[model samples]
Target: MNLNFDFTEKRVIITAFFCMAFTIANLITVKVINIGFLGMETPAGVLIYPLVYILTNVIADVYGEKIAQRTIILGLCVDILFVFMTTLILFLPSPAYYTGDSSLAFVFTQTPRILVASYISYLIGNFVNARITAKVNEGKEYSSTKNLGILAFSELIDNFVFIGLAFVGVFAVTDILIMIVSHWILSLIWSAIAQPFTKMTVKWAEKGKPAEA
Candidate 1:
């Protein structure tokens, strides 16, 4: 909120907030929901995951690529650690009065393959988004706001990497096709939503600085 300042504590707090949201979104989106009305499937994380990428892109495009890269690495680490912790929590004892119940246990199965896929998908998708955003903004004096192309490109990278790593050979071609379209369309909407917020953050970051002075 303090646009005129570059306080270390402030940046740290904000960074932590975004990182937590991204990590949590990764956790809860493991369930693939089939829409009852549209007869379509989509990631529960779709509601929040693109926002994470949008944040990283803005960080890379505005502050610097180093920051963006660090954010991705740190975010991945947090997500990985949290998942393991959650698995452990589930392993802990429930009340002795209740016999073992498989009803909910199936959801938190914590298979090795699932863990590996999640890690790979998140890292690859996030890194790709950061790289593209930074590259596109490179050598430009000021932000151009004409970044709709980034939406499509980011979604493509995220979708392909995630689909290949996580869902490859596990689903039909038609299923993959649906995912691609969903990611692309959702990303476009997300990018549009984030554009103004990103511009504001950048301008604030540049505040108190002269034009090339």
Candidate 2:
């Protein structure tokens, strides 16, 4: 039996690994930073969260749906493990001389509502993004426009689910609406801005391979 390993395959695996790591890290620190503008508030996670979708699209485009789905599931599992570990750490008594304990707790101690929201939003968003991208790519070459459209819808769903679930009772109705709209719009714009880089990544990943139909 003969086995083949290639640079492009290695790049795809590395990219997927980083994307999964980023997703978990971003979720963990999502509440660490909050910003307000135009009388609306949103978590700093917005800036980095779109990369997860972008990378997932690239994987689905260059590799396949199965790999992308597996990546998303892997990310979810990592996130769960991260949450569990952080919770355990939060429970342990801080060293008497460790001055950063408060800061660490402040950053890692997520409320139950926010944690649930993060899980729901991420699973639904990444799954939908990967599925839609795969379905669109079937027998068709990559289309940034179509991909953007799919991503926009998926992000909208993600923002709605996350904000609604996390802050429905904690914030006023209007504020929640603002958060959803702001997050959805910003995420769409971020993905659009990153489209060129995504194309480059996909092209790089697909190098030395037959072009898709």
- lDDT (Cα) of model 1: 0.68
Q: In model 2, which regions exceed 4 Å deviation? A: 1-8, 11-37, 210-213
Clashing pairs in 1: none
Candidate 2 residue 4 C-alpha distance from true site, Å:
14
Question: What local lDDT score does residue 68 receive in model 2, on the 0 to 100 scale?
Answer: 82
| TM-scores for the candidates | 0.80, 0.85
- Please report how far candidate 1 places residue 162 from its true position, in Å: 1.2
Expressed as tens digits, the lDDT of each residue in 111-205 for candidate 2 is 88878888798889888988988888976878889988888998898889988998898889988998789888888999999888878877766
| Alpha-carbon RMSD, each predicted model | 3.5, 4.0
lDDT tens digits by residue: candidate 1, 1-213? 654455344346446866887876766676776756456677677777777776776667665678888987888778778777767767788887876546446655556765676667667777777777778888674453545566567667767776666776888878887777776676677777777776776566545544442
What overall lDDT goes with each candidate model?
Answer: 0.68, 0.78
